[model samples]
Target: MVGGYVRKSKAKGSSNVSYSVTCATCDEVNILSHREVGGLTLPLLHSSHLYRVHDVHRTSITATLLSHMFSQSQGRAVKQQLRFYSSANMSVNLEGNIFVTGTNRGIGLELVKQLAEKTGKEAHIYACCREPEGTSAEALRGLATQYPGKITIIRLDMSDEDSILTAVQAVSEQIQTAGLNLLINNAAINKPDSLAQLSATGKKDMMEVYETNVAGPFLLAKLFHTLLQTAAEGHTSEGDKMSCRRAAIINISTIISSIEKCPETFAQAKMYPYRTSKAALNMLTRCQAEDFKIQNILVTAIHPGWVRTDMGGEQAPLITQDSVHGMLNVISSLSNKDSGMLLDWQGEKIPW
Candidate 1:
């Protein structure tokens, strides 16, 4: 059995709508939002058919469902709104102060670069890395230089607790009481370890990876809880809504973290250290999502896919920009319902 719930909101010069369906056969709820611009409706894919959708464009039912939603939303009162409708590679307008860790290279650098392109002077992006002056972060430095006042490069070693506290203090002093809009825990370490290499050194490597991947994010969230809450509180009118335009914690996870899919993936290469650590990180995402719900701070795990980064290697299929682009769309379209879920770069939920 399936049931539908429709909601809409008007923002600036555009009309946004959300039509969600609850299915007994599928996951609990799937939300598909849309934007109306000059009589044209652009669909924002936020489907709940996790088992059915592995790719965004492949979901045939998405258009049909949006078509029905548009028809149903006519003459509806503006009691609630989804606020934004976006797709992969689409333009997005984000407000408030944004923070991202691991901005030196790979997806982190790409995220900062793309964000700087979208953000204006009114907004600020704090791009954190282990070394702001290091040779590796030269590109990030150049980006910060390009953006000037729009982007601040902060020194943060995610594995070090003192460094996290220092980073938090630095960010807090700059944003004042306005609070942080987004916290992307994009910094992570994937120390190479496998079942075939089980030894003291491998076990040591596991702990180091876990410390950076799981424990670092945990401390960062704990220290920045106040800033996140302040940001969320700013949207009192839309307190019920969860959005990146407000307060959100985006953990840059990987689909390789999926334990259920391990049978197929493990055969390819048993990335024991990286996989297990990310699995723990997913748990952190869920716990934070639950704990921060009343505060209206959204938290979710996102699998950025196999990208051609230093970590992903040259043979990896997807480009960093493409993965970040898709992730931005997914992050922009997140709602209260998405908290605690594990979603891919394409906005489809991944199995635990």
Candidate 2:
């Protein structure tokens, strides 16, 4: 807003008329000379405020140049104004089209509370739960009351393929009219059942945790890629100009997956299967990030700080809100630079 641009165009001979215009976004000025200028209507060259950060700024420069040609015919040339806003200058609305898996309890529950209760944005929360309609926890009921249209309780059992398929179909239908922008894969199980416990995890239970914790979110992202793309397209179509941003995927992971930083001592330390599963999830985060780079989808794992929950128990170090608040801040700070990272609640990069 502090500065604007000026542009000028000129015709060579006595029969030609000259034109001048200025852009406020960038100080760079352009001058054009046309020999035979007539009743040709051209687009007005707007300043490249948003395009400055993109790799393809040339496209914008060309468009601006073409617009300048069109502006000469009209006596009053048009100036497409641009105003720059940074994270420091403007408050970022951290809520929008969101899809959160495993939102019935713990971090997932807290995420819904913060996004809907605190931020109060137009959030479409897909609260994926085993028993979505009737959870034992009354806090969720309170949440539903507080945020009516913002929350949609979807019955998604991560382990059940049939349930996942059904949920996917419903999601596809819901997003056809609108679209999903944010997806949080927060539903995970950390029960302390070891390899030796009950002879190979009953095949049902083995796949159950993996299906929900890992495979379900993986499949969901794959399923919603097109929806995300369309939503991003809509965003660009609106505003002064299009943005390069896309949908985001946040995977709730544990520091126990960190080979070097894993806790040395825990009361229930013999859960080999759970530990291995989370480690695999960490790898999955990296895989998704690497694969979806072009889609502009940032996939990252977060170690929600130790909290007092059903899984963390009463003796945990942090409370639910404290851990979730920090994680939310970290999420709010996410940019293109921080994609494909394994970070903690404090936004510090966690060890692999």
Candidate 3:
């Protein structure tokens, strides 16, 4: 429960603020040497308290910085004040590259907004959509304008192999070698369908849905695998617990896709194509986790719940903000033990 930062006096004849943190375990002060004032959250060795560790330029997290940021309550939700502090303008040293799909609207847009709002200026975000300059991406454009270089909007079409390749190459160029820390396969599609609607064209509808929801994620993971691997290997310690601190791939999956729980959920809706494709996506998540774990990359599937969004009808109980808020927290706390599992926005495990 002990947390807060103090502003030290300005350096002689310098405009930059002199920032320091008193190690909670031993009051050993660590001065933040940066071009300007910024902050990062750190729990130093033998400390029961949380301290903010800030720097304008963050070299790396697992190398010489605070190896872990969790408090004693690792299993519990992070305190409200900490979350607020992170979302505030104060810089957090999450200096890594992140790529997200379907950035135009809905959950993808919310993810991009929250990521931009939460992480520090050091984090580079590539917001990918089918039409980066098209009319649909105006809000995304606004975000790019608002945050300046913090986010880069890239053109991506989940269903198209060539477009995905071009996006990968562009993103790889922007990020230094082995620096893609997070990849979120959040882009997806859903259309009206039922078993009764499964005519020849309905079958084609199923294939189309599969192309975007299942195949897109699969291809992205395959192409980005080595970059993700290199990022993980740079950590230099396999003992480091799996987190976004390590390279991570978060596949935005759904609860309706759970085969064991389908009987309980079937009465709600019967969108055949959407349901089947997500089921396939879940399998992809499991397969990726198995393949990537040894390389120190963390992969998992998250169900954002039936939120009130373009795809999730207005009648749904959850809102986009709350769902994304919980999801970001869950993602931050993931360890190797949780890899390959299906988890909810609150970090609760779901039956595959």
Candidate 4:
């Protein structure tokens, strides 16, 4: 027998009472409202009947029920699955910092993982991607579970100005709690083409790439400059008059952008768009670094080495983790004395 207890609902001026029925099976209780039982009665009569759903809610419910069916008791359980996930690429954790960007599958994704795993320092990695539900982001969710309170995922497409603005607003809200320290510009892309092919595509793709890779980082830095400065000003170090070390901006760049070290192979390969965009980025890094000099913000461009991510491709020499580790070594070794200098992964200054 399906033994149960029914709780009658209390409503004013209503005789059609609402009741919740609790059924015990093997000493485990399952609760359902009378209305719910009524709906199920038809399914019991027609064994072929199946409930259908239209969207994510249905999918989540199905997955949740399947999980619960295997459990010993009909107890309510909060799903351990992550709704969102992210990683802030970091090598070593000097302090708890906030990192944000899109397209985490390549360099961006690797950076976030290394930051959390290698640094042994607390990090709040805000990793945004074009599709939060995409398979590429699933590994990130796993990372979030591995390190609770360490990562967050959001939808961010740098090409979309509104999304960029929204990401900044969210970061502003988070900084109130954890306090942001380093803002790393790690997300970048290149439209594969020669100068001849680029000319055919005209100014459109060029501007789009620049908007995402160059302008977006500049705007993000500008919006958070005050917050970063404030956070930095709160901490103090030995041999420092100020209460805190100034916040730092690490602008991820490419060696192809270096005018002094431009490889002949790159030009022959026709990677003009990628190279020029980063060159512009390097200049912007210089400008911002100088602008915030008095405010105690250290900004510099860094060549992370040729890494073997999607952008770097299989032929690229350096591993993503190795490149990031080298870069972190440079960052950790930096003194106020080294501010504003363009550096390579090895910590040597790159000629502007």
Candidate 5:
């Protein structure tokens, strides 16, 4: 199903009439032309087209059409009027405050970089990392400089609760009453451990991984809960007709976290610590999704795919740019229905 409306084109030419229809289901935007409807009025044509193509119809199509006709008859210009409905692409509101953790390198750095490029001044992105002066962190700092006020580099050590609180406070002061719109829990650590090597040393390594990958995100979400709730309230106040308008938390989990798809041979490869921590992180995502439903915050776990990072090494199938790009697309398309699901970079649901 799709809904469409006609608006006066702001383009230089008066004859330029642009009509946009977005699918109510997928939210994919389709730019329509008069040629496509062969002179039929846009509303009537679109109503019939949606019914025939998507089997979806809105009862207000007639009212909308009459209203548009009335405006034309009155010799008044119709400004852009929008009716909100849930759609995959429509869920992404880029003009909001977004925070990304572990922005020094790899996927985190790429995500910050791409987001800055995509949203420009429309978004305020807080890029957080442990060491602000490190080489990779310097690169992120350069991006912040390039984008100026759009990006702020905050010091955040995922293992340190005080550091996390400081970062949250910094974001709060910057965004003020606007609140935090999205939190990307991208900070994580991976340590390889085998069952055969299960000893005190291996246990310590596993605990460290758990602290960074699971506990850190859990605590960050807890500390930022109020900001997220405030953002949700602001979204609702906008009177967007969308069924759900919630702030979002994206946990950067991995496909390796899936216990259901784990093969015996792969499971014994001495990567137990990394796998177990991500699995725990996935569980945390599910718990947060259920717990935050009351506040209308959408929490999701996503696998960014095996990309060519320091962790993924040379033979990795995807590159950081491609992986981050896909992940952003998936993130932009998220609805409340997707909360708590373990999804891939491409937005496909993954096994538990």
Candidate 6:
């Protein structure tokens, strides 16, 4: 008795009875004696046996039972679809409105490119860069053309507050009520300087680096706080109890920022200005993670490895695609538990 309504009858001097159930999906009638049903009631046995024996979508069965049990409950119609695939070939799709900074070249540009390739058609990507006419910008524009409406190039000079505000306004107009699901604080600058150079410059290089690396993300997060909150709110409105949707902020930090792991041999050639600013960025990430917990926003710091870009130089050990790909996988798998952590491209935790 697996799919239909159950009726009970008492038998004289015997505790056993017979019941019949009709499968909802296959409409097959099954008759079972009380002894065969074991300890389970008729309805429970029917539901469990039908699910185990049939290939019906699990969600469909749950929805049907809920609807039948609460016919007057006015539940919304549910649609169920199932897809089966091998674990070896699984691919994750990143959905929602995404905004990435420093996208004219290097890691930021690569992130935009790969996101376009991996996400669904409904995904909207806003690629931000300071110079729109540069060679790297031209390449990003080509990607925009290739992807049609999925990619948009915006001007964002992270060092300038006016430019940041303007870019935020533009993104706000585009996203409107949908809000931004992801914000990547990837724009940064690095000027190689030693202790000797710092003595002559009197904090000028440090100030410049801090402005773009630390202050930029701080201002950007402050300005976009509402939009991120809006995205989190929208996730709750979906009415799906199992939904893991959330808004996230990713800070592109570096492994060189690690104070504990800095090589003793390279102390003289240390880029102090760059390293200190990134360390400060990591601290900011921790603060944001704590403050944004109530809003359900995930904040994290990631080191993109030594990628061979304009900043990383030609001799760098890692390539742009590999670094970006690994970081994307890390970002896709992040949960609230991973917030405030300093992780490398491989998703391994790095010591502060």
Best by lDDT: 1
Q: TM-score of each candidate?
A: 0.74, 0.66, 0.73, 0.68, 0.70, 0.70
Model 2 residue 201 lDDT? 53
Question: Higher lDDT: candidate 3 or 4?
Answer: 3
lDDT of 4 by residue, 221-269 (tens): 8877877777666664532322112377888887678777665335434
- Candidate 2 or 3, higher TM-score? 3
RMSD of 4: 20.2
> How many backbone clashes does every candidate have?
0, 8, 2, 9, 0, 4
**Ten-residue segment with the worst summed lDDT in candidate 2?**
46-55
Give the residue spans of candidate 5 off by over 4 A: 1-93, 192-201, 237-246, 264-269
The TM-score obtained by model 3 is 0.73
Query: Could you tell me which residue pairs clash in candidate 5?
Result: none
Worst 10 residues of 4 by lDDT: 56-65
- Residue pairs with colliding backbones in model 6 are 1-21, 2-46, 3-22, 4-22
Inter-residue clash pairs, candidate 2: 4-24, 5-22, 5-23, 5-24, 6-22, 7-21, 42-70, 43-67
- lDDT, candidate 6, equals 0.72
Model 3 whole-model lDDT (C-alpha atoms): 0.73
TM-score, structure 5 vs. true: 0.70
lDDT of 3 by residue, 67-98 (tens): 23232222222222212222323333344888
lDDT measured at residue 214 in model 2 versus the true structure, 0 to 100? 82
Write the candidate numbers in order of decreasing lDDT.
Answer: 1, 3, 6, 5, 2, 4
Q: Write candidate 2's Cα lDDT for 65-104 as tens digits.
A: 3334344544444554432222222222465577777777
lDDT of 1 at 307: 67
Tens digit of lDDT per residue, candidate 6, span 1-352? Answer: 1234433344678776654444445655455565543323222201221111112222121112222432322223222222111122234446789999999889998898888987887788999999877776998998899999999999999999999999999999989989878999999987643333554544778889899999999999999999988888888864321112358899999877877767631353367788889999999999998998788888999998766688766544456766777788888888878888899877889887
Name the weakest run of 10 consecutive residues (lDDT summed) in model 5. 45-54
Candidate 1 residues 38-110, lDDT tens each? 1224211122111111113232221113444445445462221121123333466577899999999999999
Those runs of model 6 whose alpha carbons end farther than 4 Å from true positions after fitting are 1-91, 192-201, 237-245, 263-269
